[model samples]
Target: MSSLVSFFAGAFIGGVVAYIFSRRVANVQFDNAKTRDKSQKKRYKDIYIRASNQRLSLGPYIVAIGGGTGLSTLLKGLKCFTRNITAIVTVTDEGGSSGRLRQEWGVLPPGDIRNCLLALAEDDSSLNRLLNFRFDRGELAGHSLGNLLLLAATEIAGDFRKGIEELNYMLAIRGQVLPVTTESVCLVGRTKNGSRVEGELNITTCGPDLEELWLEPRNAKPLPEVLKAISNADLIVLGPGSLFTSVIPNLLVEEVSNAILNSSAPVVYVCNLMTQPLETEGFSVWDHAKWIAKVLRRFPDFVVANSTPLPQDIASRYIAAGSMPLLVTPEEREKFKKIGVYLIEDKLYKINEEGSVRHDSVKLAECLVRIARSAREREIWKESIQFSGMSG
Candidate 1:
């Protein structure tokens, strides 16, 4: 009996020692795994940073011109491709929060500017939410937080342009947003009935076919920075926004049009997905391009148009709202070919969750990047040929 008890004691001691040793080994392995995970994470972060910096330096410089959601949408997509983007926004906004701020503060409308700024924001952060916030009551009722912020920023910086610069720096924005002009001006339109309407709000709401459209201050000069951006751009894009109010207003600035004409870069126009109720009722894609060419006295080298069909339900909704899909008829297409404009049509639009038609930003950006790449290849090929000829 004494020998058996001694044997049992020995077994218990051995079991405890074995368990403790295994536990220590497991803990050491776990510690090593954690350290390796951290190291891997850091390495990935470093690589991403380096890659982003490399793309920023090597990407082609692109200038996108328009206003409202269209320009912002383009910017959102293009930022994924290149950090070197310049958004030239129109300044003729005279409705909603922008109009109210303009009347009360005597400043250029901030509504469009705010949208561009948020679109170019590096991330969807608290600042973006703060800028998009809106007031529901009191003196600030119906005012957008971004418009008020821009107004305050203008006051703090002592100049509208400087205010934008400060905001851009604070946001670490991926690209630059420039107003088409600094002068405070209203959009004017003439009805086919020989009546004149002023202010963008009145003009759009008039519900009549517009005979002509112009700015209140006909000679509103384009900003020098805008001209410089155009001159330096590898590619220039126009529109995908309201044809008369958003797109053409930028071209109304004489210097802006001239710069576009003089620039060696290829100019591309993004046609709207649908005809706007009052602004572009019964219009076709060709009508939009024709109007643009008429206003600028020149046509774009290319037009990016949507070839996607809307879902049945979404199509019904738009039709109910009196909007129609902008179709590119065969005759109009021939017109584009005759004018030396390349019409690149693709599945460029989609219905968002809100049931509104929106351009696929990523897809659009891809097309623009492809075009830029092709342009570069052409440039290189031309240079090589010239060098060979000279040497020969």
Candidate 2:
């Protein structure tokens, strides 16, 4: 009986010892996990702080002019380089959901502005998809949710410009977007044959070469903020978009064009990747630059052109759709140089899985930043030289 009692006591002591060891081990594991988590958090905090500092101190003031996917694409790339960006969007859209909204609500077209806002949003992955959601099989068919939200915002704010400002804040976008003009204006194109075409859609679709382009009323004033942005900009960029419809429409606003010309900032023009049917058919890089010069009344300081060739399948697809790549020849490069415009050529294109081509945004932004730095240095040197000469 005594032996049985001793065996039971030993078993009980063993169970107690095992429990205590397990509890100690669990406590050690918990402490280690806590330390690891704290270390990871510190690392994340350090990264965030560094990124914030770079954005604040390293970014330059830039004013980008144009409208359409081209401007949005550029914005997507540019926001990575600078927080001080002002996008001057053309307001003469007369087709698609923007057209419908304009006609129905009498508001400025929100499509391009929405796109720019999305491109600059802090977290655009889910929001981009959500806002770009289109409806079908209802009265809302063919209208994007973003357009509707912008329309609603305009109604709530009781002013178009105010509404846009509200959205700029609400979306927490990296930069500002301004319409070239707040007034209701129509695009009018005078064909080389002396025929007048009215509306952006018709003009883009019109077969004849455009000899002249102007805004209706001929006195559309620019937004005051646009001029201020131009005056404050360290660099100005124009066009990777349609020449007549997207880029030139802003220039047609006399005050906007004059401000751009008067600003001390150096202007750079990004040439289109492919020639659009009827709009820029058979046009070379020089041809695009010449048109911009004609409208701006002076040549841009630099022209960024893509020198990379498209894949065979993509090239064939684009050709089939009546579009061709804009090739820059050696002769054209010499012509640009003669005109005092620097030609920047590089492999600046990317082809999507669906055979669509676009400028590689990150690569393009890096190039623009490099150009801005060089231009700023040159300006400083020139100023210093002039000061020295005066002192002497």
Candidate 3:
């Protein structure tokens, strides 16, 4: 009876302790549940806000390299997501309106940069018409309105970077427009026949095919900010511009390539939709990648290439001009894969009524936003990273 009493007393004490511990555990679980619920609600709200402000986040240190309308078009798409796009445009545009401006003003080439800025400008700004308007008569016959603005601004600021800053505010632009170099840069092309051409336009006239295109000054200094932007960019885009004049010219700047090679950011090359006659005649997807990779010292990680085929009739039209459809064959993809280049094949071609290739701006923009968001997610661990969904 004494042993039985002892056992019963022990069992009773044990049960009491168990009951207290269980109550404490239950209280903690309940509090935790409440906290989780609160956190979930807050998370949902943040997602909602991010979705609404999706475009705004894209405004952080995004840099675009290359020149011409291709670079400008990309800027148009990028600006939709974030105002923070910095364009390091090529000044080797020695064609039509741009060429004339460079010759007459004795100023840095501003035509391509001007177009890029206008593309990023908020709608209905005075900066638009003022910069793009054309003159029909006078000594200024063919000069674009934007080129004049830049020239005037350059003169006033006594610096190209300063002019771009002033214009950025007035236009409510998302980022700064920087020249590849403040020094006057001329495009140099060495033909397969051993003939050397001195200007971007001259290269077009010189050839059935190009051997190599380089920059004069051989030691062109890259804009300091351009170098900084490349160093800090989460992403760098090479182009859909003229392969020789617009794209390669920037890379030829020794400092520009060095900065890009040093950056931890992924470099994406937006391949042109159509082959250009003189510069990239008969060039294929792999051809473009090979040339660019070799020149820049490292192949691009991602190539956003066009997979859409041109209509036979349109293809014929291009063929007449000695241009070929840019084929992204399996072999071509493999060639790129041999290097660090990965292919992002998508239908991003929009042909104008004039039967010329154009960029699918909306699709391209969507791709860029997706890339940025995914990159951010990977950078920040899920425990704290919140994604802003599409606002539109």
Candidate 4:
């Protein structure tokens, strides 16, 4: 009993010391973050030139269409490579904290869009802090300050795209972000084998049996700017998001899919790290590719796959949550090979001690630049062949 008492006393003292140190560290970090924000404003003013000041070049343009964390994660990295980027995000989400805001106010949910904007913002910028600010209590306890700002802007501007444009200006964001559709839309999903699910969150987490997903607003129109962005892009990126919800919803717009097929740009699909039980249940990387291609009138020119193996410990945690790392199948690789689609193999995931699988943004972005450059070479080759044939 005496030994046990002494051990407990020692542990308590050590824990108390650790807690105090942690709080002090946190305070220091907060101060540093504030200082960083102050300096960023001056930096942007010095560097970000107006359209007239920008150098004119016919360089490649990239359009990334999708919503949710996956798409934002990709954007966080992609922006590092090229300044000409366009993100066409989904607005059909109506669940969780985002759902409550959508109900209380008849405006597009701001959760996903807010995330995309922050992802494109300069690291430690004040704009990111403002956008991520959340209420601490009351009816707005769970609402994000950014969501309220977006709602106010949408109502005042009388246009959702215009609202985002203003926010972009304030943030000095690197890329352009647009909604998939302007009409308020909801996601409705049905299981592959059976059952119907409604609402984006419900459909995404309901089960591993989803067969198809559709938007509620059947007459929803694609934003003209989104279509224009796609048509002029030199490359388009789809996926690395909820296969149906984030990815397919954008493609569901007839004009959006048509733009992909018609554009003289390479299409690349970034496969997910794992299958979401409620959405992509039982899907392989190839299954995801096939389903997305089904929606696209033309197939992709390149596919980026996680050649890295996920840690078993992290996999166990995911299994407990009813999800698993998406495994690539041999047949799928062969199929892609037959179709002339190049598969990029790389270690892009880092399983932290906390058991969360995060995309190594730097690695993924670096890989994207290399692959994109290679795709450009291939495009040159194809165009050369066409010219040669014409001469013959």
Best by lDDT: 2
Q: Which window of 10 residues has the lowest lDDT sum in candidate 4?
A: 383-392
* Model 4 Cα lDDT, one tens digit per residue, 5-34: 999999999999999999999999999998
Compared to the true structure, candidate 3 yields what TM-score?
0.78
Prediction 1 TM-score vs. true: 0.87
lDDT of 1 by residue, 251-305 (tens): 8888899999998888888998888888788888888888888888888888878
lDDT of each: 0.84, 0.86, 0.77, 0.76
Q: Which of candidates 2 and 3 reaches a greater TM-score?
A: 2
Worst 10 residues of 3 by lDDT: 383-392
- What is the model-wide C-alpha lDDT for candidate 3? 0.77
Pull out the clashing pairs in model 3: 55-81, 83-174, 131-145, 131-146
Ranking by lDDT: 2, 1, 3, 4
Answer with 2 or 4, whichever has the higher TM-score.
Answer: 2
Question: What lDDT is reached at residue 190 by model 4?
Answer: 81
Candidate 3 lDDT, tens digit per residue, 1-392?
99999999999999999999999999999999999999999999999867745657545456788888898888888877776678988887776677786777777777887888888876636666677888889988888887888788888999877887888777777677888898887888777888878987887665345677788889888878888888777678888788777888899999889988888777788888888876667678777877788799878877888777888988898889888877588777667767646567777878878767788877786666566555554663213223243110
Tell me the TM-score of each prediction against the true structure. 0.87, 0.90, 0.78, 0.78
- Lowest-lDDT window of 10 residues in candidate 1? 383-392
Question: Which segments of candidate 4 are over 4 A away from where they belong?
Answer: 1-59, 124-126, 190-196, 205-208, 351-355, 374-392
